[model samples]
Target: METGKRVPVKAALKSHCWIDANDYQSLYQQSLQDSVGFWRSQAQRIDWLREPQKIRDTRFHPDDVHIRWFYDGELNASSNCIDRHLAGNGDAVA
Candidate 1:
């Protein structure tokens, strides 16, 4: 009931087709329940030069602080954003 708080609610139909409320809730739940699997699935959407075998690296001690995600994954942002879209949406404005 408070502002800036996240709460799951039923899906609602809207003009936008990218994502809906229910889909977002489902993704949020999956992210919490299986973080590694959730992130792996999301990573599949990108073009990785070297696919990552590990999803997370949280091996840290009280004195050491280090965290990483998709470790060792290599990807080109220009290729993913521009090259990949050249076939269908090259002329389309971003």
Candidate 2:
């Protein structure tokens, strides 16, 4: 008799095509060390209508709660998701 249930591995679940298995440790370490810099680099991959001047902003109080990312950035969601891809993958099915 065999049980079909299986536990997922963390590495397998977090895999990325852009990152190599061997480089994962180093990249993880770098991210931990410089999260802001890492995220700034990652943000460059996206198309921003207006680039952010600040990475994050946070203010917490009993009356007011504010948390923001890319505070100065502006972007069109539809353009980023569909319009950008139309040129390369328009005919190809999603």
Candidate 3:
């Protein structure tokens, strides 16, 4: 409920969560060490209309700043987020 507060992941997530607490730290370090390779693997987990040719185009300079990730990839975000869930969740609203 409070901004900037860290939530206890074990209490918030099911026991079956893909990444456990230790995994979080390891993954964070991996991302820092090899951002492109790390993100490339993560991107494959999603459905893409067309896979990305370029992974990122980020600029952090004060005057010119922008971040673009998977900009070349194409997919309907709505289908992935909402419509795709209906088949499994529609009849199991409990």
Give the TM-score comparing model 1 with the true structure, all chains together. Answer: 0.77
Sort by TM-score, best first.
1, 3, 2
Clash number by candidate, in order: 0, 0, 0
Model 3: residues >4 Å from true position, as ranges? 1-16
Q: Once model 3 is optimally superposed onto the true structure by TM-score, how far is the C-alpha of residue 89 displaced, in angstroms? A: 2.3
Assess every candidate by TM-score: 0.77, 0.68, 0.73
Q: Give the TM-score of candidate 3.
A: 0.73
What does the lDDT come to for candidate 2?
Answer: 0.81
> Candidate 2 — worst ten consecutive residues by lDDT sum?
12-21
Candidate 2 lDDT, tens digit per residue, 13-33?
667456665688887887899
Which candidate model has the greater lDDT, 1 or 3? 1
Question: Per-residue lDDT for 4-80 in model 3, tens only?
Answer: 99967566565769877789999999999999889988898777889897898999999999999999999889878
Error of 3 at 58 (Å): 0.9
Model 2 / residue 23 / CA error / Å: 3.0
Q: After superposition, how far is residue 19 of candidate 1 from its true place, in Å?
A: 1.4
Residue 56 displacement (Å), model 3? 0.8
Q: Once model 2 is optimally superposed onto the true structure by TM-score, how far is the C-alpha of residue 73 displaced, in angstroms?
A: 0.5
Is 1 or 2 the stronger prediction by TM-score?
A: 1
